[model samples]
Target: MKHPSVIIFFLLSYVCCFAQEHTNKEVDSLYKEDQFYAGITYNLLGKIPEDVSQSGFSLGFHLGFIKDMPINKNRNVAIGLGLGFSANSYNQNLLINKDDLGNTTYTVIEDTGTYTKNKFSSHLIELPIEFRWRTSTATDYNFWRIYTGFKLGYVLTHRTKYIGDLGKIRYSNIEDFNNFQYGLTLSAGYNTWNLFLYYALNPIFSSDARLNGSEIDMNAVKIGLIFYIL
Candidate 1:
């Protein structure tokens, strides 16, 4: 027979192993979902001036991470704050030009057939704040969600390009563009497929940026899909 001390040591080791395994099997009661996200959108322009119109398909892409804070005990309702980046392009008949004297000009291209491509693109760093409601549980992966939020963005860079009969014209970091942009956003869906919409509350250009003596007060409207991942 073994000594009593040796037997006690074996018993203690077995108990410790069992406890460790049991702890590993236990699930976390406070789990969060959809903390990381990526999305793509179809961009549209609103409040266009006369003879100004969009042409080709304008696109926007976004990716972000949100800090999910559960408001209630169930963790189904939460507030989310996040930082993200977005790249957007608007393909339209509006032409932006700068002269040698550093003066900028905005023109409406009446003849769409003359230009093969005319577009302005912007890259932004964004801050998103959201009110989120979902039918999700800690163990459930598939659930319905509705998230509404406000997003504020600062332009990191912007460029305008035109390719057509006129010539290949390009401008970078136009000073006339509004450096800050804000919008309302909505995202709703089940599981992985979510519909996303964004409507800008302010114009893309400042009041000083004018077309034919009128302020080119155009806002952006985006509709598309957003995917969230754990």
Candidate 2:
């Protein structure tokens, strides 16, 4: 599979989760630690035509491990770095097409009965760096945390799926997608129920992508829940 990296990444996380178990005192004394994080997010296009707006739930997910380096004596403040995999899907009315001249275009598909489950998905391998704050002491299992970070991602795969008058159809390895993506992220909550936020800084598609002679500069935003395990 093209995404063997994702499987390998998760297997590493599963191993790390079991390899480390620390008492309260040990946790407090440790200058550095690592954690596994997983999250599910709702995704939406930041910019899109009104006629081509999202038609259904757009979901995304991420999983990975982060090495935390304590920056303060209290161990409540730290910096983190990690590698992860992320996948995002957007369900919308827009259809991707290539013109006779061989240029990619986004067109609004207005016939609802003619098309169902029009969605595009992309998978990425990402590196994340974050500033972390927590109220946990060595013994505390339930604590407040706020983590804000930046992520750089390289696309591994891109595909589109739809059910239409022609029948169920799928296309993979879209060529016009941007291969590199960078974004900002934030997660804040108490204990295990963290609210996650992600905003893409660059367009999902390359500048060559066009709709009606205008550039299609759509970006993605995600919001949802994140869970961290140590």
Candidate 3:
């Protein structure tokens, strides 16, 4: 899930609530610090009609920061948020064919066509704010924490591109992604660092009969390290 937006919203709301309920000094003393981490991860995209080529993996890495605090007087649960960035894309080489009717659509070349790679890469701004429920508390030296939540964000780049038989092409906000950028993130790793999977409830790209559009699937799978400072 690309979640900077959701996390930011939740964080702002949390801060506002905190300011109304407790003193700034008390909030600072309890919140403590934040942590940062970076590592390699894979991006799995459902892909869009930019299908002038074949689709496959374009490797990348992710870097993130996290912060958390307890909820109310009950230390058993914590509210946390994180923001991260991942370099991701899809590469596809397709077979372009022109029909007698002047329609330029692609079909299998029966083992005779060549592969032209259509590559796309973008830096994702992610934010995940979570309400974590812990079963056990950590000692001074050991921290054992588990949490889950949702995230939301928009594609911050020309995240969609075409590099197949057609010349290089890029898309603006108009028809890119579902236009509703949000995904569900479930995670279980460790403190300041954990493995997570983000699932999108909406298609990254749109599907319509008009605009010469094709069905482009754009959900993704990401595995990376997470860190929380507080």
TM-score per candidate, in order? 0.88, 0.85, 0.59
lDDT of each: 0.86, 0.80, 0.51
TM-score of 1: 0.88
Indicate the worst ten consecutive residues by lDDT in candidate 3. 106-115
**TM-score, candidate number 3:** 0.59
- Residue-by-residue lDDT tens digits, candidate 3, 1-230: 24533444454344434423422332323433333434445556544344233346555455566676777554657777778765555554433333578444433322223334455455567786777765434322124556677777656763445544445645444333453457776555544355666666676555531223445455565665444332
lDDT of 2: 0.80
Clashing pairs in 2: none
Candidates 1 and 2 compared by TM-score, better number:
1
RMSD (CA, angstroms), candidate 2 = 3.8
RMSD to the hidden true structure, all candidates = 15.2, 3.8, 9.2
Q: What's the CA error at residue 212 for candidate 3, in Å? A: 8.7
For lDDT, the strongest prediction is 1
Runs of candidate 2 with Cα error greater than 4 angstroms are 1-28, 31-34, 99-103, 166-169
Q: What are the per-residue Cα lDDT tens digits for candidate 1 across 166-218?
A: 89999998888999999999999998778999999999999989998999999
Model 1: pairs clashing at backbone N, Cα or C within 3 Å: none
Scanning candidate 1 in windows of ten residues, the lowest lDDT window is: 16-25
Query: To one decimal, what is the Cα RMSD in angstroms of model 3 from the true structure?
Result: 9.2
Give the higher-TM-score candidate: 1 or 3: 1
